[model samples]
Target chain A: MTQVVALSGGIGGAKLALGLQHILPPGELTVAVNTGDDFEHLGLSISPDIDTVLYTLAGLANPELSWGRAGDSWNFMAEIERLGGENWYRLGDKDLALHIERTRRLNAGEKLTGITADFARHFGVLGRVVPMSNDLVRTMVITDEGTLDFQHYFVERRCEPVVKGFAYAGAADARLPAQLQEDLQDPSLQAIVICPSNPWLSIAPILEIPAWREALLEVTAPVIAVSPLVNGQAVKGPITKIMSELQLELSSASIARFYEGIIDGFVIDKSEAHVAPEIAVATHVTGTPMKTPVDKQRLAREVLEFARSFGKL
Target chain B: MTQVVALSGGIGGAKLALGLQHILPPGELTVAVNTGDDFEHLGLSISPDIDTVLYTLAGLANPELSWGRAGDSWNFMAEIERLGGENWYRLGDKDLALHIERTRRLNAGEKLTGITADFARHFGVLGRVVPMSNDLVRTMVITDEGTLDFQHYFVERRCEPVVKGFAYAGAADARLPAQLQEDLQDPSLQAIVICPSNPWLSIAPILEIPAWREALLEVTAPVIAVSPLVNGQAVKGPITKIMSELQLELSSASIARFYEGIIDGFVIDKSEAHVAPEIAVATHVTGTPMKTPVDKQRLAREVLEFARSFGKL
Candidate 1:
């Protein structure tokens, strides 16, 4: 049974997932990565979030850019740009192979989970990396410009469009991977850590799946969420901008409130510690900006210790 | 009016094609590259010969390696190997973009000819690059082991399999692109140059196409072939090995004989000048190994000058 299950989107989420995997025993962690951000570009199936988690756990994450693989080359993108092909979504040279291989496997009738897990093994990642679901769960951004595919809205448009709301296009029909479902039911499972990622764009896509949500809800393990924001600002990505655009309060309490019925505990940054008292469930405050290895490990330890204080929900 | 139409496969063919394109008036030369070597790999439509011609004419051909784009990175193939992918067919990082973009455009319903022309323009190529046919024509190699796809036989197996014969799947059904049909019919067209690519592997696929061969034969321009062999040896690629395996005489006369009734002229090497008498058509002998820009230009000039001496038959 997996001791820790961290669920969230790319970059930021991958950080915490790496920390958990490192601190836990080998194979003790399961990082259920959001596949909503996956899209077909230039006839390639790209799962950005899943690759982030895989790269991070494999110690291949690009420390310079805080995303993609370490030492990843951009020759592929350069040639794509030169050829007047789709150049908005950047694909690094080394990273391209993974996408191509994954797409090939998927086309060969293998599930995304199997392909991801196999890639994780090949990458020498310590823990398992699985997609939220085998089925497509596109995160469609309902922006003022128009409804856009997640990549088109986020990458191509540079998230410039004013947000109205979001939708998980295939979430209603998606089912949790059978192994993941079985893992969630295991009593040895300690907690579900929803890492600091975009709530509407990343976590919600996974949550919108009725089967996954019900299975997660049935699990006795406490579900904890770490605030993606520090000092009421996102450590990375467009979280704060999205919140402001959505007319939501720029505070950790607002983030906690969004997961009201789902999470058993919430961990905010020291800057937003004041808002913790306003939360209904248990809450903890810590410095959550994961820049270095120590930063990630410290935060991971803090989250785990926080979860230990409460009994299984 | 197009001055020259060169037909052949990769590397050796691309060398002469580059020479013709460089010497002729910009856009006067047309390169009809073999699509028989094209195949769906990693779900991307890969046109090996077309890309070779495109890269060669664009001043992007790898000078040292003599294939793919210049300064092409291998990180993609390296990572593919690491991920246990089908890495036998080496796809350079820069070359990958062409395959992907071509595949994407094809999926969007664009014809290969239109894509090739557009790619040629984008490459700043002096000459027009074209597929022999818009339809898929896969070259299947019959070997001692079994039948193998062109790429499988050429790249994966490294041509170790003893060749029995070859077949161009879909060649009979494929039609000439309308623009090419019109180009061939143009009264002002000059000679057709058969580049020094393998007669069986490179030139045969195009010849197998009924429409293209018929249109080519109906043209008033003289049809001439430049020997891929010099000193009874291939300048590049598997001509000698395949010829020996297929039990054919490994000489320029044999190459010219393969094109029997279709050609009015042939060019052999100075070393193979003796065999010129065996060929019925007008044969020109010169140092045909294209090592430098001067060599390519010299050969191109010779082929055109020879064509001009003859009346359109």
Candidate 2:
């Protein structure tokens, strides 16, 4: 009857989140998704990470794209491009329903947490999905070109810009959602799993909110992370390139070092287990690449078992 | 070459507008579409009448529905409904591109006229398609239940409300688009054709603008209207029901009387020619049912020929 909380970003995080959802008992898992990449595009409020988690958990995610809805059409994007609207961030036709409905509810004064919960229920997601905060916390990448919004850098620019640094705009004022706070304080709370998403781009935004880090420190539950890097390369996305641009060591040791003070344990790919001696925390070497549902479930089981080894569960 | 300006609403008006586009030389026909029905739904600015005119003129309109794009898919609406969002308005997947693009440009400080014109050109529409004005002018339908916004009354309520009257919410301050004003004053302007859209819902919103009426009266060109009612029934929409509720006689003569002191000619269906003598304006009884492109062109030719009898063209 252990309750687990997972902090997630987009694709990679969503994969492990899906894994966690499948392996965990009903109502035992809760996901706090990054909203730092949320932006208003073409007048619709688009929450990229939240939608990825929703689609992935609901089993509606496009397997080929690893984002958006399955069996999705591109009529909206094609027509938008024809009309000279920005088409860099592709919005699938069926996927647009989520953005439009979320935007409508947000404009109608509904909180993001409530809206996300409602969407999860509507889509038949087994576990709870909550936004990290109701308030704005945009991730701004200070690149060589200029300060670009997270989506502009990651999607529009295709991560082509050399990263100087990142700033979590509005993080100073953002409060952790009450749901997340209450979950963290629950008596049965056993573990906090940071999924294999980019540390700086995904997990950092959640951690940058001062209260979030403070809350994690206060929790008795063992905080653990699955490394996004395997053999000094990202399993997906631009994490390796970003690490190189920021002049950080491209290794699992670097990831462990990044979360040194917060996490009690780190999960890295078995191929790179040699670097475990340099990690400050307890290290678990496992098969971390989640290509199939079986892979996700297996990793989820391994992570939970690893967390249990800390004498909490 | 004669230049004609047409005032239109949705479906019916779009039919006649399409006919005008076919019969008139390229760039000779300009449509001033009613924006009173424009409302923010799902956070997207939906100019229904403007889009209808654009789709009809561009040959993308559905012959079956006469409103949305041909071969349109309803995945967006279906998904929106599944998500518990509003589905009564029925925005098709392809049609949503127009609304999303327009909403984006409007938020970017572009005029509705410019955006619409750009869309028209993008869609390969030869004739100009512009909104009646760039400013907001919502049509509020006063019913026995209470006042309802145009879309609420027409789409959500299914035109079931007992109509009392209508109020153009922002008509007093709305200015005619510069393009419409310039077109009206051009020496080559020979006629202003009022298409067969519901006078209460469509054309009236455009005509309700005080400056619009004043400018129309000052023009040397003939002002003509195609009757929406035929033989005590509407060719489409709720014209007959609204007329009965408003205590007006259900006849083509009543339509002519509605535009009294504004129009110099009225085109009605030949089936109702017996009531022509009661009309104050010059009545032209012809085959006005535009079911096909050829039919639209024929009606357009006849209406133009009838307008020329005023000695302007």
Candidate 3:
């Protein structure tokens, strides 16, 4: 009867979320997705991280790729091109429909939390998928190349810019979504898992909400973080590149240091077992490459077992 | 050297605009498009009237239809269906691109006039396609069913609702686009042609602007109007049905009366020749079935000839 809450962004975060979903009961796992990348494109409210996790968990995500739906068509993007629009973000026809619906619902004054809940129900996702906040919080990456929007730095520019730092626009006043706050305060809550998402770009924005961070710290549950970087290289995204730009060692050790005062435990990939000694909190190693459903389930079970060993229940 | 300003909406309006484009010199024809039907769908600021006129003037309009581009694909709408978005608006992929770019520019604080100017220049439209006003003036149809947003009545519901009347939201504060007013006041201006678009739906909204009607009356140049209704039926859109539901006679003669104080001359289709005696203004018959490029040019020439017959110039 353990209630597990997992924080995630897109891609690497979704991998670990899939694992958690496999091991947790239907109502046990609540996922809080980053909304920093949400922007109005082509008049659609596109929450890239939420969609990626939703697609991944529904078993509809492209098996080879971390983002977008599998077997999706480019008919819509091609047509957008014919109309002389920028197609750098690579929205598939099926994906475009979700964005359109989300945009429509959002414009009609529905909260992002409610929209996410409806979308999860529609997609038949067994676990809850919640946006970090209902407020607009765009991640602004201040790079040596100049201040760039998150998508511009990641998708449009292909993450080639040298990062100076990052700022969460609107995070100063952003409150945790009611659903997320309620989940954090639930009596059944036993653990919080920080998934393998980019520390600064993804998870930091969610944590920046004062109430969100305060609620996590106030909770009695053990907070654990899984490594996105293994053996000095990130599994996906610009985590390692950003780490180097910020003059930090790109390893599980650095990952632990990034969340030093926040997390109670650090989970590293088996390949980076040597760096376990340098990580401060209680650490463990297990199969962390969540390539298949079986791998996801196995990792989920391992994380749960490791949490139980901390003598909470 | 005559500066001709043609006020238009969709389809039939585009046809007359194409004709004007053929007859007028570059920069001589300023086409004021209706923005009453404009609404944000999927976060795209869609100016349907402006796009129709732009595509028509550029020779990119569908030959068989007066709206949208030729060979347009529904990939965007199709994908929107997959994501469970509103499919009623039926945005083609290429059409969505126009909306996306327009929305992007709009969000960036660019004026609707400048965005449209860029779109017109990009599409190779020789005539200027100016929005009636930079402000958002939405047309709301007060129908027997309910008050419906312009697109909700026109596109989504297929204009089936019984019409009571209409009102332009935001018209009280809407001023003429500065450049449009400047062009209208130019000494080279000779005549203003109101294209064969729906009077209540298209033209009424433009006139509803606080000082717009005054401006139209102040200009001494003969203001001519083309009838949308012929033989008691509208060539396109909901003009005939709307007229009948509002207790107005569903004919070209009634159309002239509806525009009574505003116009000095009226152009009717050959099909409406029998009803010429019923019209208040001086009326003439011309081929108004603008189903092709030739039809547009021919109609434009006829309207110009009718204007010249006044003998003031």
Candidate 4:
């Protein structure tokens, strides 16, 4: 009867979401993905984080590409480029179906929550995957080159622009999706696992939402955040670079500090065990590098065990 | 330099558009395609007739499929079906590129005319491919099953429903694209060739536009129409069925009668020579069956010669 709510971004977070989905029973885990990275590209409402979680949970993600559908072809992108279309944000042939369908449904007055649930059900994904909010909430990255949308800063520029700050546009106005509010209020809920995604770009946007933040602060369930950093560098992506650019310490402790008031415990890699004492909340030192299937489940088990050690068991 | 303005729909019309492009110098021909067949599919603006003209002129059309880009894959459609998305109207992988780009540009405030011209330039199309108007004009087919959108009636239902009537929604209010207006007023404009396409479904949409019709009616150029039928049967598609359903004779003379005042001459297949005497307008008997590589060019020459014979030569 245990239920969990996991917060995730794209690629790296999806890896952890995959781990948790594998460890938990079907319909038990609820992955609330960041909608900060969602943008309108070629008239498509692309929820990068939501799609990653969906693909990861459904086991449709390409192992090599790290995102998008498995065995997806580049015929669509190739033709777009040939026709002088914007090909920077490549939508693979198979991957494009999700964007198109999602956009279509969204345009037809369906909420993001319903569409995500429907897509997951179709793909036979274990557990539930929901967007942090049904309302529009975009992450605008303030960089040396000026403010750019999340995808333009990330995918189009390859995260090259030096980060100054980030603005969670519409987060203040964005309300929690009804189902997520009900899920958060459920007395049977065990813990909220924050996946190892970029804290500023991924988790911050979700936490910035007033209703979502208020729900997490008021919920009885333990909220645990895993560090995206291994030691002083990111496992992948520009987390380290962005952290340094923002004049923050490049360590798991800094990441733990970022989520200080919101999270109950912090999970860091065993390599950063020395920083465990620095974290104000209870800490779990585990092998968080989810390279293999065993690694993901092992890390997931350890995190849950750590949460249970706080008198819940 | 002979300047032509060819009116077209899709598939069957594209063949003659290609033939005109092959015989005429680059930029000498302007294929004003029907916007009636155009619709928003999955939030992407799809100009079926315009794309057909573009592909045919660019030599990128699939010879086997009679539609879509050459060697385009169906991975996108397959994935859409798997995701429980609408798959009735199939948009191929490579073929989807144009729709996406055009949709993007249109949302960004670009006109269909500019986008079509840009796409044609990108593909190195010999002749200009332009939508009939920048404004929207959708075809509504009133059938026994009810009035359905053109694509829903044609692609989804495979034109099985009995035809009752047709409506060119927005056609009356739609104005001709500026370039088309200028082309119509050109002193060197030799002729206007209406390609062999469905009269009610294709040409009617373009002709229904008051400004476009007036331009053709008052232009100092010859207007010639190519019969879509061989004897009493269409070369491809459900033209014969729709004609019979509409309580009209399945003959080329009936088609010529439909274009009575607008067209100066009618080009019929040699097999339909028997019906030529029945046509009110001056008639030219030629090989209208554009089945072979030579057939298209040969038919193109015959139509052009027929047009030139009316004082232009």
Candidate with best lDDT: 2
Selected candidate, larger TM-score, 1 vs 4 = 1
Range of the 10 consecutive residues with the lowest summed lDDT in candidate 1 chain B: B179-188
**TM-scores of the models, in the given order?**
0.97, 0.96, 0.86, 0.96
Q: Top DockQ: which candidate number?
A: 1
lDDT of 1 by residue, B1-313 (tens): 7878888789998888888977899878888889999999988899988998898888898888757888888998999889988877889998999988998899899999999998988889989888998988889999999999999999898899999999989999998888778778777788899999888998999999999889777889999998888887887778999999878898888898899989988998899998988998999989899889999999999999999888774
DockQ of each: 0.85, 0.78, 0.31, 0.83
TM-score of 2: 0.96
Worst 10 residues of 3 chain A by lDDT: A75-84
The deviation in Å at residue B4 for candidate 3 is 2.3
Worst 10-residue lDDT window, candidate 2 chain B: B228-237
Report, for candidate 2, the interface RMSD.
Answer: 1.0
Task: Show pairs that collide, candidate 4.
Answer: none
Model 2 Cα lDDT, one tens digit per residue, A145-188: 99999998988889999999999999988999999999999989
**What DockQ does model 3 achieve?**
0.31
Better of 1 and 3 by DockQ: 1
Candidate 2 lDDT over B1-313, as tens digits, reads 3399999999999988888888778999999999999999888899988998898888888888858889888888878987888778898888999998888889889999999999999999989998998889999999999999999998899889899999998988899988898999999998999999989898788888988999989999999999987677887799999999999988998889889989999999988899998999899999888877889899999988898899965
lDDT (Cα atoms) of all candidates against the true structure: 0.88, 0.90, 0.84, 0.89
Q: Report the error of model 3 at residue A281, Å.
A: 4.1
